[model samples]
Target: MSRTPPGTRADYAAFTPITTRWADNDAYGHINNVQYYSFFDTAVNAWLVRQGLLDITASAEIGLVVETGCRYHRPIAYPDPIEVGMRLASLGNSSIRYELAVFAPGNDTAAAEGHFVHVYVDRATGRPSRLPDALRAAAESLRAPGSGSA
Candidate 1:
């Protein structure tokens, strides 16, 4: 099987810094693989919040994660100051795919790279919903060159 190459910081359009908790480490003395997904989620949602596109308590439209996958280039341990870089890989009527990279402090290349897919849904009905204009614009701001509609 071929491996996907790690992404560089320039490949992303937005960035969010994340602190690794001591508890995030596992018996292997590194951040557990599962924790990378948490980082991805945090980075994306935090960006949404910053853009005023999401209101956890009252937004009528919410995004439900539909898919996620990661590729690890190296293990990162607790206390490592890291940053998650994000960019829109594609956007659809009801879904968006975000490409993310985890970088150690001062690094230009990623230690891990991942993709996360979220399907926008009606908060009350839990059914798929079209992306709101504001949300679409915010998402578009994170699109790297060459990324577009899904």
Candidate 2:
């Protein structure tokens, strides 16, 4: 999804600190590729929950992941923490695109970078729904002004 290289340390907004477990590593001795997406999911949804936009268990408006992509630059191993940085790339009427970068603790470069698009839908009918006002504003706050020009 990116034309440039892996994200550097400068591009993100809020960071969520995450602990890595021994099981997070694969036989190759690094964090498995699939686990990176889990980090991305946690970082984004945690923000949604904290913003009071998502109930997860009862919210009628649910955001379902429709698309996802990632780019890896380095390997991460257990015994180190992760700083998962996140930002909103776009806030649409019914969806939002979230960009994420996972950096090893105390490191300035990213181990993996990715984006996920979630389309808000009705829990009962599973139909697409417009984003709530509060959620849109929260998403807009994380969007860089000039980042979505294209």
Estimated TM-score per prediction?
0.94, 0.91
Candidate 2 segments whose C-alpha is farther than 4 A from its true place: 1-3, 145-150
Candidate 1: residue 88 lDDT (0-100):
85
Q: Compose the digit string of candidate 1's lDDT tens values, residues 11-83.
A: 8899999999999999999999999999999999999999999999999999999999999999999898899
- Best candidate according to TM-score: 1
Error of 2 at 81 (Å): 0.7
- Which residue runs does candidate 1 get wrong by more than 4 Å? 145-150
RMSD of 1: 1.5
- The residue-level lDDT of candidate 1 at 66 comes to 93
Tell me the lDDT of model 2 at 146.
Answer: 45
Reference-based lDDT, each prediction? 0.92, 0.87
